[model samples]
Target: MNSSLQLAVPATRNRAPVGPPFRRQARSRLLRADLLTVIAWASVSFAVALWLADGGAAGFSTPAGSFTALGIVAGLIGMDLVLLMLLLVARTPLIDGAVGHDRALEFHRKLGKPSLYLLLAHGALVAIGYGIAEGLDPVGELVALWLLVPDMWLAIVSIGLFIAVVVTSVVTVRRRLPYEFWYVVHLLTYAAVLTAIPHQFSVGGLFAEGTWQRWYWLAICIATGAALAHYRVLEPLVATARHQLRVSRVVPEAPGVVSIELTGRHLDELAGSGGRFFIWRFLAPGMWWHPHPFSLSTEPVLFDSSGRGRLRITVRNLGHGSAQLTRLKPGTSVAIEGPYGLFSTAARSRDRVVMIGAGIGITPIRALLEGTPFEPGNATVLLRGHSEAELYLGDEVLELCRRRGATLFHLTGPRSAGEHSWLPEPAVHSGHRLASYAPDIADADVYICGPDAWARSVISAARAAGAREEQLHYERFDW
Candidate 1:
C-alpha cells in the first residue's frame, strides 16, 4: 500500500566503474576460503604429528601394536573433524563471510558421515588391538573394558548418540521426520562430544596431563565450545536486546505468502544489503523456539531522526515452522542472527547484472533490485513462474525496473516437459536460453534464487553461456 517504503536509489545518471574494487573483494574472499581449507587440513596433520612426536610410529612394528597405533590416529583425526564441524556451524562471522552460511553448512553436512566412520573405526580397532594383547576376542574385550574401564560406558553412549544424529541427518530419513524432531536430536551432539572427552583426557596415554599433546587438544576443544556459545547463544541474545525489534504489521502478498514488517532501533546499522538474510525468532508461544531464515523483501526504511526504522521479510507457508508465521500479531518481539550470505551487490564483479527468480524466490530479487548500484540499461530482471499469480510482487518489480531503466521479463508457463531447463516450455521448445533473455550475460553478474532443482538448472545454463563461477551468485531457498 505504501510505494514510498520501497528502497531509494541514487538519482545519478553516471555509472560507477566496477573493475578494481570488485576484483579486490572477490580475490579477498577467495583467499579467505583458501586459508580456511588450509587450516582445516593443517589441524588434521598436526594431530597426527603430535602422535608421531610422542613415539607413536614405533608401535606399528607388531600386529597388535599396529592396530593400536591406527586406532589412535583414527581417533585423533575423527575428533579433529568433529571440532571442525562444530566451528563450521558455530555461525562464526569469519567462515560466514568467507564462503557464505549456506556453503559452510553444506561442508558441515559433508563432513558428518566421514567423521562418524572414523570414530566407529577407532572404537572397533582399539577393542581388537586390546583383545589380541590380552588373548581375548574383540567383543569380549569390549565388554571387559565397559565393565573395568572408568569412562568406557560413557564413550559407548557417545558413539550411540553420534550414530543417531548422523542417521537422522541422512537426506532420505530427514525428509520423513519433522524439522523440530531432527533439531532436538541434533542437539544431542553436544552431549556426545562432552561424553567422549573424558576418555581422551583420562584414559588415553597420549594426552596425559602435563604433555604438550594434552594442552593442544584442550585448547582446540575449549576454543570450539567457546565459539559455539558466543556466536550461537550469546550473540543472538545481545542482538535481540540491542535492536528491540517488534512486529509492526503483516500484509498478504499472494495465496500463501505474507510480508511481516518490523520496527526497531538503529536499524541502519543492522540493515543488511539487499538479498542478504537474517534468522528471525518470533517470541510467541509454541513458535518462539523455531528460527526462520528469511531475506528482506524490501530495504530497511529509516523513518525518523532518532535512528528508528522498519524492515520487512516475505515468507511463504512452505513448512510447519513457517506456516505459523502467518498468525503473527503486531508487537511480538523478535530475536535475530545474521545478515548472512553473498547473494548481494557486494559480490558483483561486473557493471552489468542479471537477476532471475522463481516463485517466492522472487522476493529477494525485488529487494536486491531496489538498492543495488548499476547503470540504466545495464541491468536485467527475469521472473519465472508457472503462472502469473505465482509471481509474487510482480508489479513492484516492474515498477523498480522501469524507474531504474533496466530490462524486465516475466516468463510464465509450465516448465519444460522432458528436459531439465530453467526456461518455460515454449521458450525451451523455441531454443531460447539465458543468452536470449540477456544477450550480454557473459559480462554480467547473474543472481538466481528458486527451488533447488530449478536454480541448479539456471546455474547450468548460465555456465554454458560463458558466465564465470565467480560471476554467478545463487541463494538456496530450501535451507
Candidate 2:
C-alpha cells in the first residue's frame, strides 16, 4: 500500500546540472512537430499534383468538367486527411515523443469536421457533375452509380459511420456518452474505412487500376494501417507477454482512491523515463476489454537481477470501468500498452522544476518526483485539494520532498471565488500568486496535472510570470 521512492541514491546536496541543455531539447521537439506539419500539407499538395500530372487541369474547360475535377481533388485531400488522423493516433513513438499525446490528439480531433466535409463534397459534387454530363438529375445520377456497382452502397454506409464517429467525438456528445459507448463507436471507424475503399478505387477513375497515383495512395493507406497494427496491437501483445504482469494487491489509499500494485517479470523494462503511463487491460470476465490509462504512482521496485519486480498505479473511481477495478482480485492477468507520452525528464527544458497537482492528478507528479533528477532546494511541489483527504498521495509526496530537500506546499480549502484564480480563497485574499511560491518559475520547467480549468489557471499564471511555452508541461487525463 505504501509507495517508497525508487532509485534512492544517497542524497547529494551538491549535485550539478546533468541533463541536456534546455534550449536544444525544446528546439528539437519544435522541429519534429514542424516536420510533421510539413509532411501533412505536402501530402495534400502531392495529391493535387498527381491529378494535374494526369491531365486533370484540362477537364475544367466546361462547367461539368470543372465540377468533376474539383470533386476528385476534394476526395484526394479528404482521404489523405483521414489517413493522417489515423496515423496520429496509431501510438507511434516518433509522434508521441515529438508532439506528445495531448497535442497530437488535439490536432487529430480538429481534423474530423474538415475531413468529413471534404468527403461529403466529393460525393455530392461528383454526383452533380456526372448528372449534368449525362442530362440526368443529381438524384438520378446517384441512383445510377448505386446500381452500377452493387457494393457502391458500402460507400454510403461508410458515410453514415463517419458521421457517427465524428459526432460522438464532438466535445459535447463525448461528455454525455459513457466511455465504453464512445469507445465502441470509435472502433467502427476501421469498418468505415474498409467499406469506403472499394468504391473509391473502383468507380473513382482517379484510382483506376494501373495508375501510378493509385499505387501511391494505396501505399500510404497500407502504411497507416500497418502503423496502427504494429503499435496498438502487436507491440502491446509483446509487452504483455514479456512482462507477464499480474495484480498482486489493491490497497485503499483514501475513501475512494486506491493503489493497484502488480508483480511482473522484467518490470524494469516498463519503467520508462519520468511520469510515463500505461494503458492497462485486466484479463477478467467483465473487464478484459476496458482500457485504463494510468501512470505509475511510484517507481518500479526490482527484487532481483532477473528484473522481476513490483509497480503501482493509483486509481480513483472516475468511471464505471475504474470503479470495477477496485474489486480486482490478486493474480488477475494484466495486458499493457505502455510507457507512452513525454511527460517526463525527456521534456525538461530547464534545471529548476515546478510541479503542481490537484486530486488524483497528483499521482503522475509523484512518480515524476521519485525519478526526475533535481538538486536540493531546486524543485517545488504544490498539492491542492478541498481537504487533506482529497490529496490522494500527499503523505508520500511530502516524504519525497523532504528526502530530496525540495520545497513542498499543501493548499487545501474551497476554491477561491475569483473566476481565474486556482488558489484557495484565503491564499488569493492574502495576495498569493504562482510566482510567490516558485520565484524561479520563469527559469524552471513547470509540470501541472489537475482538473482542466484549474490546470489552465495555473498555466496562465505561470505564463504571466514569464514561463516559456517550452517550459510549461501538462497532460490531459480526460479519458
- Could you tell me which 10 consecutive residues in candidate 2 have the lowest summed lDDT? 1-10
lDDT of 1 by residue, 10-49 (tens): 4665544433466677788889999999999999999999
Candidate 1 ranges beyond 4 A from true positions? 1-20, 418-420
Best by lDDT: 1
TM-score, each model?
A: 0.95, 0.95
For each candidate, the alpha-carbon lDDT, in order, equals: 0.87, 0.86
| 126-195 per-residue lDDT for model 2 (tens digits) | 8889999999898999899888866778987888899999999999999999888999999988888888
> What does the lDDT come to for candidate 1?
0.87
